[model samples]
Every structure is written in C-alpha cells, then in structure tokens.
Target: MKLSSIIFIWGMLLCSSLNLFAQQTDFKNFETRESTLDERWELTSESSQGTFVVVPYKPIYILPGRWSNRPNKLPTSLNPDNVAKIPNDYNNFEARFQLSIKTKITSGLLFGKGDIWLGFTQTANWQVFNEKLSRPFRELNYEPEVIFNYPLPSDASIFGLKPKMVGLALNHQSNGKSLPYSRSWNRVVFHAAFEYRDLSFTIRPWIRFSEKFDTDDNPQIGNYIGVGDATFVYTHKEQVFSLLVRSNMRLNNRFKGYADFTWSYPIKGNLKAILQVTHGYGETLIDYNYKQTTVGLGVSLIEWL
Candidate 1:
C-alpha cells in the first residue's frame, strides 16, 4: 500500500474513534468549567455568542526585519514548467507579516455539541530592502479552511491530559501565482486539543488530496512540509511561549521536518513584543522544499490562547 493511503486510513480511523468516544462518554457529571481551548473555541454557553462574530484564528504579527540564513533563489519542482529559469533577486532580510481571522458559521450538531467555523490566514514576505531590483513582494500565501469542532466534556481526560476538543477541517493553501511561481494544495486535517495546567497542546495530522501529476506544483511537498504538526503553548504570568514541530515521519535516513520557537511578552494593553526563531523547510508555501534558518522580531496583536 502507498504511504499516502496508509496515512489517510489512519487519520480516518482516529477521527472515528474520537467521535465514538465523545458519543459514549457521560457528560452528566461533567462541569461547565472552561479551559483555554474551551474559551478559544467558545465551547461553553458562557463563551459562545451564536455565529457571525469575527475572532482571531492564529497569531497576527508584523516582522519588519525577518532575516534568513539562506533564501531560496532558484525554486525547482518536479514539473519542468514550474521550475524557475533565473535565480530570483531576493534579499536575505525581508519583512514578514501574517493576518488570520475566523468566524463561527453555525452551532448545535451531532448530539447538540458541534460548531462549524470559517477561517482565513494570509502570510506575506516583502522585499522592502531590495531596491536594486525594485522592491517587490517575495511571496504570499493564503490559507482558508472550514472546521467542524466537537467540544469534549469538561472532565474528559485522555492519557493523563485533559482532552478539550476534537475537530476536522478542510484546508486549502496557495501562493496565488502563475506558472513556475504558483503553488497550491488541499488537505483534510484532523485536530485534537489538550491541556495540562498552564500549558496547552494541539496535534494536527493531515492527509493531502492528490492532484493530477502533470499539474501538481510541488509533488514532493509532503516529504518536505510533513503530514502533521504539533504545537505546544505555555503561559507564564504576562509572557507566552510556544513551540511548533512538524515531521514527515520518514525513517532510514530520509527524514525531513521543521521546528520553530516563539516568545511573546506583553508590552502594553493587547500589544506584545514577539521574538521568533525557526529552522527547517516549509516556512512558506513557496519555500516548502527549501530549508533555512530564520530569526524574526516583531510586535503581535494576538496570539494562540
């Protein structure tokens, strides 16, 4: 069997089990207490306000100086037409920014405990310092997804960790360019959120939908970007710290992955001073197969709770 097929089956089975566990569990003894994940998704009646209200989905930040050790100048792909003939005149130091938002679409489904949400995230890299070639945007990625979230019982525990929620999402990501610069992919992502006092963990395993061989932009994207990722967030007083790890799950000397660490300290009001360090592939859709290390310092308006 193909690795992709195996991964798809496993994800489906795991989601099914989660659904069964949710259905069979007794919620009569479960309290209405809220956790960070609960508040983030508005699980309880106290947090939710029906639908159509916009909320932050991911961290929103602008890094004026995001320096990369190595930038991908010549992007190559399996498809001949998608390969860049001339190396791009990209600056090692560029400005990076991300904007993400989500809105609740509807609620009350599947035993009266499910909500759907629509989310959009946009990330961009601007070559503001490269004046010789005329300053231009290096890359832009757009991600839009639809998620169905099922909140677990407040008292639910799985393997010593408090299981907060389980969800499934249809995700589409693209660079929105033409020909050699274009890149896009679709995925079915499974989500599980857990907490353990002051720290929260989210695991997302995804299955990439196949594309026609001739038209596929990044055929080996899964090998570089990985099939899943895990995020851990820790809050200490007015400071928040996070780590994200991604792996292709390959063995025998063909391993590929990515990891990033971020620190956000409150500056004033809702503003935060943010520092981020990342190493590995897939920092952006255009850099999916390109590996590099980067450091970014910026201000953030919101962060993962």
Candidate 2:
C-alpha cells in the first residue's frame, strides 16, 4: 500500500481510541499530571520533506512552568524516526543534515523560574545545480555549532495574568571547512522570549541577536557585525501558527521571513492526523518560502501520553 494510505488508516485508529477513552473515563475529574509527551508529525507536501516534532514537558515544580526548545524534536517525515535527505533543485542541489538537542536545568523563582540550556547542531552540503543543463557544477560547505543558554527569568507579566515567564539563550555556529564555496565564521547569538496565555490562545514572542567572526580573517566579509531575528508563535487547541523574520548582512543584504500553519485532529483510537504548510523566503533552513511548498499527512503510532 502507499505510505499516504497507511498514515490515514493509522490516524483514524488513534482518534477512535481517544474517543473511547474519553467516554469511559471522566477526564475533567482526573488531576493533571506533571509530565506529558505531545509528540506529533506535521506533513506539508509529498515533494517536500516532513518533520516530526516531539515536545516533552515536566510539571511546574522547580520552575513555575516548563521550558523546551521547540523543547521539540523533528525527524524526517518519510521515516519520522530518521533524518531525511534535503531535497535539491537547480537553484539548490545540495545534501545537508542538521540536528540540535537541548537539555535544561532549572531553579525556582518568585514570579516564574530560571533555566540553563545547552545545544549543538551541524550540517555539511555538496551540491550541483544547472538551470540550462541536465546536471550542474558542485560546491561544498559545512557548519557546526554548540552553545550555552544561561539562566533567564520570567514573571506573571511575562506569562500573562495567568503566570509569569521570562527566558534568555546564547547561541553560536561555525563553518567547519574552508571550501571557497562555503562561508566560514563563528557567531555569538542571544535570545529572549516572553509568553502570555488567554482563555483561547497561548502566545510566545522571541528575539534573537547574533555577532559573527570570520575564521579565515577574510577582509571583504570577515568579522562582520551580524543580523538579528524575531519570532512569534500562537497556538490554540488543535492549531498552531507562527512567524519568523531575520536579517543577515552576510547574505548580500538578504532578509528572510516565514509563516507557518499546522492543524491536527484525532481520527479514532490512539491515532491522529496532522496537516501543515510553511511559506518562507531566503532559505527553508531559516524560513518558509513559496519556491517550495511541503504538504504532509501523518499518523501517530500511539496516543500522546
């Protein structure tokens, strides 16, 4: 059977299971738990690769609330468990993979809490693109990054009237090879986020800043001051939408932006189906663009526990 058919069937099963469970038990009567897994897959298009994101949360114990990096994970859509190959075309015919895992430690605060985080990711690429010919030339490049986010604070004003939250993060990325095709530089990044919740919506707005240093000390583009990025996300039951904008001086005065939408529903049992669309400019790695539209549908192996 085709993969799409399989995913559809599985999602239906999950929805069925959830309905049955909800009917037999009084979810409202039960107390909320501290730890939960809200893992899910958001598919865009068959032509575009898929992303599986796992978001895990721990109850508000040491900290007023919880903190995660997207605290979410994405694998390839085809396998969902494995990293997938990046699609290539005449404008972008290259191979690259990047993954970042973050761990957080926390301390209690008066309004909310504080956390320290660490993460790293890297990607290398080789591509040949030709607009006129069947095959194109080749270029090579790679970058690896590791960074630490020190303790940041939050409060009721930050989380909304409901609770308070504040956060801070530091980030850095460096190119590994000196292939003239790739730009090599080290960057220092800073991030801050404020969150608020209303009866129907949860919103998070974040800002990021970065400074770059050229490893080769190239005068033309080396050691340039960096660009900054800002992002906002709003989530309602079964729906999530977000926007991100970034400016980079290194890319010939290029500006990038992305808008994304995701909707999910349970079909039956412990299965669920999700639909997603991401539009961007500059690069998919940074934002959603129309040059590519990724449509995907996926089923959960099990209910979110």
Model 2 ranges with Cα > 4 A deviation: 1-100, 105-113, 121-155, 158-164, 174-178, 183-185, 198-226, 248-305
Best candidate, TM-score = 1
Residue 84 lDDT (model 2): 25
What is the TM-score of each predicted model, taking all chains together? 0.88, 0.41
Model 2 lDDT on a 0 to 1 scale: 0.31
Clashes of each: 0, 32
What would the per-residue lDDT of candidate 2 be over residues 1-305, giving only the tens digit for each residue? Answer: 45356436644654565455446433331123211110111011121112121121110001111111120112121112222244333333322222223333332333333334444443322221233433322222232333222222222253253222233434433343232322333445544444445122223232333223332322222112224555444545533344544433344544444443444454653334554444443233221112233333443322222
lDDT of 1 at 193: 91
Most accurate candidate by lDDT: 1
Model 1 over residues 1-305: C-alpha lDDT tens digits?
A: 45356436644654464345335432221222236677678888877767886667888777877999999998888878789999987889987888777889889999999999999999988776777656678999999999999999987776778988999999999999998988999999999998998789999999999999898999979999999999999988868899999989998678999998999998876667999999999999888998999999988866776
